[model samples]
Target: MHQIEKETVLDVRGLRTEFGLAECPLVAVDDVSFQVKAGEILGLVGESGSGKSITLRSILGIVRPRGRVWGEILWKGRDLVPLDEAALRRVRGREIAMIFQEPMSSLNPLLTVGLQISENLAAHTDLNSKERKARAIELLDMVGIPAARNRLGDYPHEFSGGMRQRVMIAIALASNPQLLLADEPTTALDVTIQDQILRLIQALSRDLGMAVILVTHDMGVVAETCDRVAVMYGGRLCETGLTADVIADARHPYSLGLLRSIPRDVAPRTPLYSIPGAPPSLNALPAGCAFTARCPVAGPECRDVRPSLETTGRQRQVACHHREEALIHFSAREAAQ
Candidate 1:
């Protein structure tokens, strides 16, 4: 683990995203705020439908038309939320790029991998056709594709699952983006291939000085790759801090439950810890704490008011009515076991 330099590159402030124009609009992301510094890898960890993916999409201005988004997506102090389509085009690929979960789907089956990568360079850079083609080959080589020159002409279906993912990464880095949004980049791969992709992303971020936001449900992946983490639940960030702090001593009940669900040194066939109740419906969320129904330590006060995020410790934020007591008891319980 290396020390992260604290110079904010992307600052998301008070972000709120919604879906539906008809009755009963759903708030998928609510008042989410976070910052990514140069070369930092921030992990957004939560179960499916926790707004992790929506929050990432909101930053890149890729949310669908039905999805209403408002807030500041500050890239180097410039707000992207108000930027028009043409202006956003200038910022999207060259400044920020994303590697989606499914690479085979993200890549074009009709086009050669080289053409797909060079398209970004052609659109965003001043490079001529020959130079763009050369750069595309270089990107393919950089992402560790074997036989880069020959493989450049291959279509998405011509490559293996991991190879297709590598092609996606090459295209994403074609414009040399400063920020990379990776939405479950390794979810579809086997464990061996997942480790390889994670290492590739880590190495690329270090070599390129690119900030990264990795959105996934795998806490183990977060532990292995992230510098800091933000844990979301029911469209709200429940806890956030350094990876070490959040994993070892989680303050929020939801975060704690997530950590406990990871199989540790327990006996074989042991049932994993699962949080009670399903995630709240965004279209009809409860007035008070969205997690109150599932939280084990919930009390009367938790049901009366929605808890806002508050500073729980140094560089740690938690949204819970019982954070203080929960931290103390949770820490003690872990120590005991």
Candidate 2:
């Protein structure tokens, strides 16, 4: 959770993404803003359908045909939003790379893992075929794949779930991207394997000086791996702060609910906590706060006005009309305990 003072590698401002018909589009991400610094790991966390993945896809320029994305995505002070397809091609996989959630579906079943890595190299680099092959093997080895040379011809199905995820990481790193986008990279792995993958990613970020944006629903993962975190709900950021700060003192109710739900140090046989009700539908969101329906402290005013994300401290932000009251309540509860 250390905040590095390196240069900002990526700055996303007012990023809005929408999909569906031209007349009746649903906003998946709404005016979301965040920053990632060189060699820093930033986590985007929320429940499913909270726009975590959509925000990452928008930044990678991989949104679907019907999807519309707007706002500035600045990479090293250069705006990437308006870049044409060809220009984006040069940026994608080279300047920026993404490792998807499901490795089984992302990797090619027919192609050798080495071949896939070589393909990425072939597309983005000037390395000759021989050099590319050599680099591919090196990448596999770097990602801890056993018998890299012999596994060059192995298909996706030949590898286990954890190994497949490593292969995905190897491919993403083939281009030496400055920014890495990992969407639920550890979702399918067992607990032990998940720890390995997360540690590998954290180590890779430090060693390669690569900035990373990790999207996940696991609060434990974010707490253990990220320097900072952004909590999203209903297509908007509910809270953002240093990982330790937000986890220890969550200002937004949504963030507080998420932290409280985690089974940490509770007595044995105690029922697990959970946020009540479901997230609001993006297509038919209420005019007021999207979280009003599920918020325990929602008042009449909460149903009539949406609160913008406001700065609560030097390195914290939250969106809630009763932020002050919530802070006081949390403090009082902590004192009582």
Candidate 3:
């Protein structure tokens, strides 16, 4: 076994979450499973409402009321889903931390940024108020906030968007977590700032030996930052493999469609093809394959059978029928079609 796959810090099995409604239930996350190894960055990529964010939230035991969650969320051999809220809170930000999407909303507008960070440290650590303040400044400094000692007195509104994100990351890292769940951390930032944030996350993953789960919609960012990637469609995982392998030899029609829609920078753009039809709504999933409606090469078989995660190679899996044909000379096939 590869070192990356063997030393997994987080292993999710058969994770499924459904929300109740009057007529139909909203299956936000459906049987999605993957492992994040120690010090590895696993990127979760998909369109909005693909359950990437919801899955991360469920891991934190923050799934909404009327939501039925099944399966195990394993961390260090223990199941987290069954843990009480108080126990989970203690585990969170210490053993496992999360940087939520939209740092501005996550941060307290009224409190000083340092206090916000200190509160996290105070919750987990036995540090005194003075000691916590010192640690909070150090955390801010580690995240590249200059004059952090002075910045401790400043509120979230005082800093720019990028700086606010750094503070959010600082708070997430305050307790020295073993795993970091970054839910679309760069979604609201500019491209230049996004690169900076991604690089910082990569640095932290390496420097601290912390596993990172990066939830994002940008395939290009995954190509740059993630060691491995999993693609989701309609609350289900479509494909997963080494970032390079998945990008080069995608074995699912949904994966192929995502790659085709976003032509790489090196590729000469030819009208920048878009996938036909929108992503399926979680409240009303299609029968069999959720992506059948949009898949270019979808067949009757795809419409009749729902494929589970099938290992096509070591540490590589794809949920799709006609996987063989999906990996065939995609560029040539596109031109010919």
Model 2: per-residue Cα lDDT over 1-337, one tens digit each: 9955699999999999999886887989988999999999999999999999999889878895668899999999999888877898999999999999999999989899988999999999999999998999999999999899999999999999999999999999999999999999999689999999999999999999999999999888999999999999999888999999998888898888888788877788877778899988887786777889988778788878988888988689988998767677656744664
Backbone collision count in every prediction? 0, 0, 0
- Residue 284, model 3: lDDT of 61
Q: Please, what is the whole-model Cα lDDT of each candidate in the order they appear?
A: 0.89, 0.91, 0.88
Tens digits of lDDT, candidate 1, 223-285: 999999999988888899999999888889889888888888987886666777788788767
The total of clashing pairs for model 3 equals: 0
Best prediction by TM-score = 2
TM-score of 3: 0.94
1 or 2, which is superior by TM-score? 2
Runs of candidate 2 exceeding 4 Å displacement: 1-4, 327-337
TM-score per candidate, chains pooled: 0.95, 0.95, 0.94
Candidate 3 or 2, higher lDDT:
2
Could you tell me which 10 consecutive residues in candidate 3 have the lowest summed lDDT? 263-272
Instruction: Name model 1 segments beyond 4 Å from true.
Output: 1-5, 22-24, 325-337
* Pairs with steric clashes in candidate 1: none
